[model samples]
Target: MRRRAGVGAIQKHRLEQEKYKEKGTEIQENQFQQMSKQLEVFRENLEDFASKHKSEIRAENALNHMVREGLAWVDSQEPKETLYWFPSMFAECVSA
Candidate 1:
């Protein structure tokens, strides 16, 4: 009887571990999707900016520099580690 209980406890522990793993995977997938959507928005905005300022090399250079700086700052941030919030940072540049 003791042996049977021990085996059952191990099985239960394994099942709990599996559940935790599944939850972790779901969270990671959600984060990935959010990041992808953010990237698409950023790309569309950049393209719009480029179109609007096609003849101005300085504008393009400034935009590129802002993007690089934003990306570097995002990289330094430990929480996200990527420029998923680029549009907000880009807006700061535009306003400046």
Candidate 2:
């Protein structure tokens, strides 16, 4: 009789553990779905913004690229009075 009772208790514990594991898996799936939805919304907003400001974005990227290249060129040159011209050069680069 004691052995039978022990077996019953072990079975009950196993069933409870299985239930908790299933619940945890469900919660994880729900959270993953929510995150995926949020990411989709974010991507849509980014696409909208890009479409609205395509020209401005392209110009800004071009200016940034030019500035980086100019700065790199300046860095490769030896220090001299011409180095002081970088500020004006960068300002003109951005304006253009």
Candidate 3:
């Protein structure tokens, strides 16, 4: 009788262990799914940001090129009046 009871206890312990393992696996799977969703959201946000800023970056580059060309032209001109006019104009352009 004692031996039978011992066998039953051992079986119960094994069943409990299996249940615990199953619960742990389920929890890990849920966490992985949540993390995967979060990662996808981050990826989409990054793409959106890049798309939005791309045009702004191009506009800024074009403006910088124009400014450089203007400076080069000013430098090539005679320094007397061009020098006086360019500084104030450049300052206004920069401040604007």
RMSD of each predicted structure: 16.0, 8.6, 12.2
Give me the candidate number with maximum lDDT.
2
User: What local distance difference test score does each model get?
Assistant: 0.78, 0.78, 0.76
TM-score of 3: 0.51
Tell me the tens digit of each residue's lDDT in model 3 across 7-62: 88899999999999999999999999999999999999999998989998886676
Best by TM-score: 2
- Candidate 3: where is the Cα deviation over 4 Å? 1-5, 55-96
**RMSD in angstroms between candidate 1 and the native structure over all alpha carbons:** 16.0
| Tens digits of lDDT, candidate 2, 1-96 | 344558888999999999999999999999999999999999999999999999999976765676677642334376653232346658788999
Query: Which ranges of candidate 1 are over 4 A from the true structure?
Result: 1-5, 58-96
Residue 72, model 3: lDDT of 28
lDDT pick, better of 1 and 3: 1
- Scored against the true structure, residue 11 in model 2 reaches a CA lDDT of 95
